[model samples]
Target: MPREYRMMTEAPPPLEITDLTTTFVSRNRRTEVVRGVSFTVRRGETMMLLGESGSGKSVTARSIMRLYGPSAEIGGSVKLLGRELLDLAEPQLRAIRGAQIALVPQDPTGALDPLRRIGSQLTEVLAAHGVERVRGAARRRAEELLALVGIPDPKRVADSYPHELSGGMRQRAVIAIAVSCDPQVLIADEPTTALDVTVQAQILELIAELQQRLGMAVLMVTHDVGVAAEFGGRVGVMYAGKLVEEGPARQVLSSPRHPYTAGLLDSLPTPGIARGALRSIVGSPPSVGAFPLGCAFAARCPHARRSCGEADPPLVAVGADRVAACPVVNTEAAVA
Candidate 1:
C-alpha cells in the first residue's frame, strides 16, 4: 500500500501529560529547563516538539525517560496508560525504559559502542530486557529488526561494527535497537540531524512506516518545522523552555498564532519569498536561570505591550485542539 494511504488509516489514543517541569542544579544555582509543559500523544500518534537550540525540547524528552543527571530535579506528573511515572524507582523505570518507552538519541555513532558489532549491541539490549532466551534467538531477532527498519542485507550489516556503516545506516541501526522490544512510546531526539537530505527523508519515512506497523506513540523533537509537518499529526512550538503554541500540524503551520511561532515560520526560506525577506526572532534564547519576568519572547516580539511585560500569559485554547500562550493572539481573538 502507498505510504499516504497507510498513514490515513492508522490512528492512536492520546498520551496525556500535565504540569511537567525539569530543573537542573549546580553547586550554587538551580535552573528550570522545562517549565510546566503539558501535552498529550494518543497511542500511535506522532507529536512533534518544535523549537530552536536550547529550547528544552531534548530536556523534556530526557525528563520523560528519567535520564537526567543526578543533580537535576523533576516535578509534575508523567502518565502512560494512566499510571504515574514520576514516583517510579530506578529499577521500575528501567522496566519501562525500553519495553514501554524507547529512545533514539540524536547521534547514532555516539549512541553505539565503536568496539562492539551491531548485532552484539542489539543482542545485549534484548538480553537486558529478557526479550530473547538465547544468543542465537537474539541474533535472529536483531536481523529481523534491522530489516524492519529498511536496512539491506540485515545479517551482514548486523555483523559490521558501528564505525563501518554509513550515517544513515547507523541511524537505522540505532532505531532498530530502540524498537527491538516494541515499546509503546518512542522518543526520537533529532534522529536525522547528521544525515544528508536524501538520507534524512529515508529515515523519516522509515520512522513513519514503523510507527504505523508497531502502533507506537512517537515524540519527535526537531528544530525544523518542515520535518515536523512531514511526520507530525500535531506540533508544539517551544520557546525558552515553554510551549508557546500547539495544535494540528496544518493549523499550526498555515496560521501560527503566537508571535514567536510566526517569527519561526517567517524564517523558513521559500521559493516565492524574497531571499532576504525572512524575518528572524531577534536576541538569543534567555539563560534558563535568567528567564524574563513575563513573556520569554516579549523582548523580541513586535506585538509586545505593557500587559505582556507584566504577567506571563497562560496557554489558552483558541480553537479545538489548538492552544497559544500569547496575550496578543488571545486578546485579538477575544476582541474579534
Candidate 2:
C-alpha cells in the first residue's frame, strides 16, 4: 500500500477534533470564539485552518493545546491517537505537550524567552519531556535539532539568545523546538507572518520538508490564500468562529463553494492587476458573541437571501470529500 493509504488504514489519526468549542469568561460575561469545529488530521497529512484575523483560527489552534488560563473555557473533544486531551489533567497533559503534540507560535520573538539562550531552551524541552535523561545527551540533542532545521553552525546559533538571531533564524529555532521531541502532531500558527518574501518561502519549505521527513500530522493556521494553496492537503475556511467551507485544498482555494471563500480568493493580488483594481470583500467580520441570527456570513455574502438569516446552514456535501455551509450555492448546485 502507498504510504498515505497505509497511514490512514493502519491506525487512528494523530489528531482528531470534534465539535470543538471555546469561550472566554471575564467579569461574569461570556464570549464564545470557536464553535462546533470538527476535523481530523492523519499521520503525514496537513490540515489548514484559513481565515481573516479574528475569525477564531488562532483560538481553535490554541484550544487544542489547552493553552488558555482560568478565564477561558473549552468544550468538545481534542484527541491524539484516541487519547482525549481536553479532560487530561495538567500532569498528564504536560507529558504529551512538546513530546507528542507541539506548537510553533506566530510570534517567534514572543514565544522565546528573552533571558534564555536557544540551546538551553531546547535542552530544557528535552529534559521536561524526558526525551534525553542525561545532561550531556540533552545538550547534544539540542544541537542536533538546530542542525536538523537547516541552521548552519548549530552550536553558535544555539548559544545565542533569540534577539541575537534574525527573524528567520528565530523562526527556525522555534520550529526546531517544536520538533525536538519528534512530536506526532504539529500546530504551526502563521509561521511566516513576520518574514520577508524570500524568508517566508524558505520557512514554509522547511516546515513542509520537516513534516514529510518526520511523518507528522500538521495543522497549519494562516490567513494567506497563497499559503493555503501551497499547502495542498485539506483546507477549512472559518468565519465568525464557525467553519464555513472545507475540502481538498486545491478544490476549496481554486473553485470555492462558499461566497466568503470566493470573495477571499477574488481579493488576492494577481499578477498584472492594477493596484487600485483589486476586489475586496466589503463588510467587516463580526465580533465574537455578536454574530448575526443565522448564517454569520449572510450579511456580507452577495448571494444571501432572507431565508439565509432564518437558520444556521448546516455543512452539507457539496462535492467529493467537501462540505460547505452556503445555502445559495447548495441550492444552485442542486438545481444544476
Candidate 3:
C-alpha cells in the first residue's frame, strides 16, 4: 500500500480548501479556471485530484500556492495548519511557502537551471528559508537531501549540472529540493508525467516513502486513475473546473456513482477488452469558462437525464464518506 494510506489524525488537517475559485480577467472575458473546488488533506494522507487535460486540475493546485501572480483573481479559503493563506501578504506568504508548503513540478528539466550545478539549486532553497547558513552547511545539507531522495552518488550528482543527470535523477533532485525544508504539505503536480512507465512507478513509490518519512500531507494531481488507485487514499474527480465526485479511492474507483467517473473507468483498457475495441467516453470536455448551465459532463454522459440540463448540481452524499454531483446517483440509490 502507498505510505499515504496510513490512518492518522491532524486537527484542521494539513491543508483545507473551500469554495476555491480562480479567474483570469482579460479585455473581453473573465475565465473562471477553477470553480468552487473543495477538499482536504490530513497529515500523512494523499488526496489525488484526478481529471482529464483542461479539466483545471493543475490550475487548482497553482491557485493554492497563489502562483498566478497579478493576472489571476483568486477567491476562497485556503487554510494551512489552521491559518488562512489567501489574505496573507506576499512577504508573509513567502515565509510559509517553502518552509510549510512545497511544490514538485511536472518537468524537472525545465524546473532546474542548465548553467548552475544541482547542489547550488538545492542550497538556494535552503538559504531562501534560512534553514542553513554558510556555504559549507548548505552544501552538506544539500548533499544529505540528494541522498535522502535516493541519488546513488549524492556528492557527484550535486556537483553536476541539471543537464548532466537523467530524467529520473533530475526528478529525484526536484523531490529532494521540495523536501529540503521538511514542509508540512507537498503539492506534486504530475511529478511522474514525464518519466517512463517504470520510472513513473518508482517516482510514485519515492513520493509515498517521503510522505511517510516526513509525515506530510500530499495533494497529487494526475489524469491517470491507475496512479490514483495505486496511491490509494482519497480521490477527487474534476471536470470543467468543478469537483464532480470525491470519496475513498477504492470506493470511488470500484463503485463510481458519477457518470463521468464511470466513463473514465470504462476508458481504461481491461483484460477482457480487445486491444482495438476498448471503450472511450464520447465528446470532449467543455472549453474553459464555457461550461453549460447544467452539469458540465451532461453532453457526454450516457445516463444524463432532463434534470441534468435544468441547472448545475451540487455534490450530494451517495455513500459513506462519498459524494457525487449527479442527481441520478441519488435517484438510483433510492430505487435500489
Candidate 4:
C-alpha cells in the first residue's frame, strides 16, 4: 500500500466544490457538461470520481481549474482552503493554479511543449509561480522535482525533451511539474489511462506517496473500479454529469447503491467469474446536450421505476457519509 492510502482523519478539507455546473455554448445553444456536482477532499486523502467515458468526470475537473475556454459558461462555487476560486481574476487564477491546485492531465504527450526541454518547461512553471527567483535556482528545483517523482538520473532526464522520454517517464515528469509548488489539491484526470498495467501501478503508487508526504488532497478521476478500489478513500459515481452515488470505497465496492454503479461493478472482471460470463451495462451513456427527463440513467437502469422517468431523484443519505440518488433505495426502505 502506498503512503497516501494510510487513513488519517485529523486533517481539514483542502478543496470543496459546491453545486458546480459547466456549460458549453454553440450556435445559440447551451449544453451542460457538469451538473451541480459537489464533493470535498481532505488533506492527505484521495476522493475518486469514478465513471465511464463521457460521464462528466474530466469536465468537472477542468471546471475546478477553470481551464475551459471562453465559450464555456460556468456556475457554482469552488473553494480552495475556503477561498472562492470561480470569482478570481485570470491572473489570480493562474497564480493559484499550479501553486495551490494543480492538475495532472490525462494525456502527457499533449500536455508538454515539444519544442522545449523538460527542465525548461518545469522551470517556467516554478518561475511563473514565484517559487524560484533565479534561473539557476529554477533549474536546480526542476532537477529535484524530477528526482522526487522517481525519474532516473534527474540531471540527464531534465535536459531531455518530452519526446525523448518514454510514456511512463513523460507522465512522471508531468506529475513532477504539477507538484513542484506542493499544491494543497491535486486533480489527476485519468493519469494512468495511457500506461500499461505495470506502469499504471507505479504511477498510482507515486501519487499516493506524494499525497502523503505533501498532505495534499487528491481528486482522482478514473474509469477503472479496480483503481478506485485500490487508491480511493471515498468513491463517487457520476452519470450524466451528476453524482449518482458516493460512499466509502469499501462499502461502495462491496454493495453499490445506484443501479448504474452496481452494473459497473458487475462488469469488472473477477477471478471466479468465467471469462465469457462477464456482464456489461445494457446501454450507452446519455449525451450531455440531450439528457433524459428524469434520472439520466433511467433509460439503461434495470431497476428503474415509474417515478424514475418523471423527475431526477435527489441525493439522499443512505448511511453515514454515504449518499445515493436513486428512488429505488427510498422506495425499498419505505416498504421495508
Model 4 weakest 10-residue run by lDDT: 3-12
How well does candidate 4 score on lDDT at residue 275?
84
Clashing pairs in model 2? none
Every candidate's lDDT: 0.90, 0.93, 0.93, 0.91
lDDT of residue 11 for candidate 4: 41
Model 1 lDDT tens row, 1-336: 999998877643435678899989999989888999999998888999999999999999989888985878999888876678888988899888888889999999899999999999999989999999597888999999999999989999999999899999999999999999998899999998979999999999999999999998999999998899888599999998899999999999989889988998889898888877877878778887688899999998988998887889999888898999997867886899
- Model 1 misplacement above 4 A: 1-14, 334-336
TM-score of model 3 (CA atoms): 0.96
Across 1-336, the per-residue lDDT of candidate 2 in tens digits comes to 799887777777899999999999999799999999999999999999999999999999999999996778999999999899988888898899899999999999999999999999999998888788698888899999999999999999989999999999999999999999999999999999979999999999999999999999999999999999987899999999999999999989888999999999999999999989999998899978888888999878889899999999989899899999997988887899
Candidate 2 versus the native: TM-score?
Answer: 0.96
lDDT winner between 3 and 4, please give it: 3
TM-score between candidate 4 and the true structure: 0.94
Backbone-clash count (model 1): 6
Q: How many steric clashes between backbone atoms does each model show?
A: 6, 0, 0, 0
Residue 312, candidate 1: Cα error in Å is 0.5
Segments in model 4 whose C-alpha atoms lie over 4 Å from true places:
1-12, 333-336
